[model samples]
Target chain A: MAIEVRIPTILRTYTDGAKAVEGNGATLDALFADLDARHPGIRARLVDAGELRRFVNVYLNDEDVRFLDGINTALGDNDNVTILPAVAGGSV
Target chain B: MKYDTPLEAVGNTPLVGLPRLSAAIPGNLGSDGHGAGAVRLWAKLEDRNPTGSIKDRPALHMIERAEADGRLTPGCTILEPTSGNTGISLAMAAKLKGYRMVCVMPENTSEERRELLRMWGAEVIPSPAAGGSNTAVRVAKELAAEHPDWVMLYQYGNPDNAGAHYATTGPEILADLPTVTHFVAGLGTTGTLMGVGRYLREKVPGVTIVAAEPRYDDLVYGLRNLDEGFVPELYDASVLSTRFSVGSADAVRGTRDLLQQEGIFAGVSTGAILHAALGVGRKAAKAGERADIVFVVADGGWKYLSTGIYTAATTEDAVEALQGQLWA
Candidate 1:
């Protein structure tokens, strides 16, 4: 099964400027692990050493994994994972 | 240990229940009978500070923390990064406390902010506008590394920024609206949300916390991707019950509506919170659910007078042009 991992614009530099990448796995952990193998520094940035970054969010098919089972959250075939780096900017 | 001026007491801002704003959304959008009286929303109006912005809270807290730890001394120079408010507030506070201040900021910040900072005697180092606050953060970090004696508050990573809210703003909210069901704020340095959100969650177990964020990848038009990424270290996404992105146009329109309907004049970020609050209110109402949406008015509208967000539009073309630059 192919899982699509979406890369946010800020982390594109770590992904060879790729917006989305395909991974072979039925589970999120497997998919992320495989993706991390391909991009050495990505897991560190997105997932930290073992825990996810406090500000980074991984949504599987538009549903947050945190509300589900976190790293164990199941991912179906053709599922899309979006990475969002939370920030806001404006005058005063 | 007596303070010289009363402005030093600016950190403890009040959090009041916004019956008007909350009723307008929940009462009108309620689906179930329970929604008529269940959720309570409070607004932690940071605009009440002397500088007309919440930045005064963190600005003063950071200075006090540094002074307590012997990291800063009287008459020493202060260095930090800001989009605008933090620098301006720090400029005012440092002037009052008798500290020399230098701030690294984006070049395209509003003239009002720049002039106010200058008026408070701050030396401004302009960063690349395209780089946004990240560049300012980077410059501040570099400056701190370069200077050994100068005190840099480092608001981006400084726990003191969030601590101020945790100690003062959060307690104020909990005290004013003990029944607060939801807390909403812009996820800026994450300090505001983290500080207040953490406090509210601890004080009120079932409190729903939400954050309004700009689209992390693109500009307001849903075009032009943003590559520069910056998230404050203090922000923990897990604490937020819901997070949504608000476009600049919607934020601007919300600010306009807030002034026209509620008589609450706030900054652009507050407009984002209001828009988010309305969305959350409607969702809860549509489901026959009741919830309170507490949002923060980060600052007053005095700094945005040049943008004309609160006035009548002379032309559609001119309004569109101004809208584009208002948040730019």
Candidate 2:
């Protein structure tokens, strides 16, 4: 399956300013590996060692992967993977 | 009642202790006035403000700073992009000070926020919700371009937000608890964390700063995070000895647990902080160490009561069934 990985605005610098890129995999883990292969250093930014970085979120079709199968969540063709960064602003 | 206002009530909020919760997590240091094992969890209750949120701190500061520098006039409209609190604060403050306030907000904001702003008499412009606050910022920028006389506070990128907490909230916490070992707070806007964290880190070199982030995928109010970007401009992450993130459901459960068990009705983000504090507490207990962790509960739970967070229908069968459906 080919899924579209949406990169956050901050991480675009690592992906040649592209907001999104294509990856091939059947599950979330495979998709991430595919992304890391294409854009080196991307995996380090998204996953830490063998775990998903606490700050990074992988949303498959807008649903949190944790609520699904976590890193093993199966992906279908044309699935959208959104990488959203924390917006920590505002007073209080 | 015609009463004198102290610079429009920019600061000076009450700090209360969470005695019940403090007991559950032992070895936590108590404030100087309290007994040992009776650690104090002081909440900087911003909900008590005139606008019911802490954004009052920055909204007032931003307006006053602009006025002091001769950049704002009575007729000029105050503009900004916000999700909820900032706009509500600016609306009440600007209207009282004789300025027209216009706010650009994501269209998906809660109905309560929109009605509150309308009650305060501020003009609201809705931007696309799918684009999040980014769209609101773009809209604000476009409006400011068309209206040359408008002044936009731009809280997302504004230093004033963090500065407000630094100058006020930070000092207040220090005065209240000079021996605070750890400071925990949610990472939204990074203003509270950045400002308070900087001040505490400087005043108390050993003070540990921890960000209680929602588990990365928890997008209740559209707040999400990526690994590459951290809100650390005013925040020094090196000062933090540890960081803990809690799942949204875990946070919600924590809030409910605190309210029922400890009687502290704080918001979901506060629950995240509490859950993180408990994690820190458990770790300290295992090491047989004493550590005082102070968490900031930004607001009361009144705003989220409608969501039924505190009123979950957790029957025995329901609980078991929900647990049964977990993915292997």
DockQ, all candidates in order: 0.19, 0.14
Q: Candidate 2: lDDT over CA atoms?
A: 0.68
- Candidate whose DockQ is highest: 1
Give the chain B TM-score for each candidate. 0.87, 0.82
Worst 10 residues of 1 chain B by lDDT: B216-225
Q: TM-score for the second chain in candidate 2?
A: 0.82
What TM-score, to 2 decimals, does candidate 2 have? 0.72
For model 1, report DockQ: 0.19
Candidate 2 local lDDT, B253-287, one digit each (tens): 77777788767777666777777777766666667
lDDT per residue, candidate 1, B1-328, as tens digits?
A: 3456767658566665555555666445433343334444556778888888888888888988899998888879999888789888889988988999999987756788889889999999997664566667788888988997888888867899889888988887777666667777876687887888888888898888877764332322221133335667676777788765665666777778777766777876788787878777766766766565678889987877777666747333324544433242
lDDT of each: 0.72, 0.68
Query: Model 1 clash pairs?
Result: B39-B292
Highest TM-score scorer: 1
